[model samples]
Target: METDYAIIGGGVVGLSVAWGLLRRGKSVTVLDGDDGSFRASRGNFGLVWVQSKGMNQPRYAEWSQQSAAIWAEFADELGDATGHPVPLEQKGGYDFHFSEETLQARIEDYETLKAKIGGNYPYEVLGHNALRKEEPHIGPKVVGAILHHQDGHANPLKLLTALAADVRRMGGQVIVGKIVIEVSKPDSFRITCADSTTYGANKVVLSAGLGASKLGPAMGFKAPIRPQRGQVLITEKLPKLINRPSLIARQVDEGGIQIGATNEEVGHDDRVTQPGLSGLAAEAISAYPALARAQLVRSWGALRILSPDGLPIYQESADMPGAYLVTCHSGITLAAAHARLLPDWLEGTGAAPDLEVFSETRFAVS
Candidate 1:
């Protein structure tokens, strides 16, 4: 019997979509990549961030806000089902600025975006002294921060483990080590693997991170996405010195301060560089002086799956109507929306969201 949905890509994006569909009583199967695949899910800063996103697209900001609002409940449900603790701190997070000019400029840009989105962005501009009151370890070079109240961080590995477990708990099948090379829609969708294995489903979701570029064109998508390398660093577990998360650094639930994420335009190279690590360390130490004494634990580089416009793509294939391409950079931030609201869109329910803005038509199809 054909499954209701055969989801390609077992990363957080695909699994979250699978989890949502399974909650709606749909038969689902997830085809996960092997060990050799570039898994962004493993190498993220683990922030459920909202600030500084969607400066151009108000709808993208609104969508991220929707996901952030329900993230706690999503974590609780996942933990209760899988008995795995997914630690999340959602008090708020910061977008730090070292210069007054940049801070004011960002505030103006945010004001424009806030007006477009009906002023739902909850944030406060904290001066350095005010920020020091909240975080005493803040360095003097820091100018200020925009504390967006909807932001937070989580343990990504725990979230992934729990989702994989709960997907199976809900009777969803997960197949690993199968690289999907082709997809064809006959009466039902037939997914062909690189090794000649086949799976059948009434519908297909192409959420395979970087691999979507290879299969999307055949299934009717331009898939103009690229890989951006982000180098991240982690220090040894220490006593709480930082209170909130930033684009610069955040203390993880495991007691280590997570610093990083240098956005480099290196194609498909998720390997760390000395220069990348050094730059991240300088910025982190400048933000928090105490980090200068912290011992380094590990560092890594992960490739971010980004679209041409830095927005997510959620489009159903025009030629193959039942197949969809779902890719995004903020998989951790959008997991709640994908697991709760996206199934309605996929199933054509009246509650489906207005996702017309995210369609690939925005990009010129060659």
Candidate 2:
């Protein structure tokens, strides 16, 4: 049977869009790569965060807030449908600062961004004393923090499981282990897999993360995306220690202290290094001195998909009218928007979001 839409990637971004389209009564087939493909969705830090986003582009920040606002409803619906619990905490998150100078600098940036976005940014700078009152375990070295009320985190694996289950329950076909080879459209779109399997659809969505760099130009998209390596670490499950999630660390739903993510631009290399792990441990320990005694459990490295200016790229293919390219690094944060609001834009309804700012026109062509 011919599907209504053929999603080229089965990651969170692709699956979220698939779920949205299926809810709109559109048949979808998600073609996922094999085990060799770099799967960023599985290795992310699981933050539904808003801080440090769109510091340069307020529109991006507003979009993040929009997603965070509706995330609870999104999680609830998915949980009700699939019977999978999505552990989420959205009271607030932090930007922990070790020194007053850095804390003051970040506050200035936040204030400037707040004005640009018409003052909707809800955050307050807590001095060391105030922060200590809130987080009794906070290290004395931590000077202060910016508590952004909208920032939160969730269990990303549970989310992925729920979305996949719900999509299938809604009758969306999910084909895995098939590397898509080609996509061509004459009257309808034709997608071919490496095993010579073919699927037909009326439209197509290219959300294959870094794989878009290859498949995008074929569908008339300037999918100029890159991969930035982020090394992460996790400690053994401990009692409730971290009160809120931060860039430095967080206590995940599973009780593990998730520490992370050294941003290294070492092109396409996802292997962890001693130096990278050491640096992360040092910073994490400094942020919470108690972590120095925690036994190390696991360490990993994953590549984050990024655009030129680090904003999302949501553009309909100009050459292939029925084709769309949707990619972003903040897949976990934006999953709610992609699942709930993005379908309107894809279906060309009046309620479609104003996503022109996220289009590819902003990229510099070589």
By lDDT, the best candidate is 1
What are the runs in model 1 whose C-alpha is more than 4 Å off? Answer: none
lDDT tens per residue, model 2, 1-366: 789999999999999999999999999999999999999999999999999899988999999999999999999999999999888999899999988899899999999999999999999989999999888888888989999999999999999999999999999998899798889997899999999999999999999999999999988898999999999999999998999999899999989999988998999899999999999999998888899999989999999999989999999988999899999999999999999999999999999999999999988566
Candidate 1 local lDDT, 1-366, one digit each (tens): 689999999999999999999999999999998999999999998999899889888899999999999999999999999999789999899999999999999999989999999989999999999999999999999999999999999999999999999999999999999999889887889999999999999999999999998989999988889999999999999999989999899999989999989999989999999999999999999999899999999999999999999999999999999999999999999999999999999999999988899999999757
- State every prediction's TM-score relative to the real structure: 0.99, 0.98
Worst 10 residues of 2 by lDDT: 357-366
lDDT of 1 at 269: 91
**Candidate models: Cα lDDT each:** 0.95, 0.94
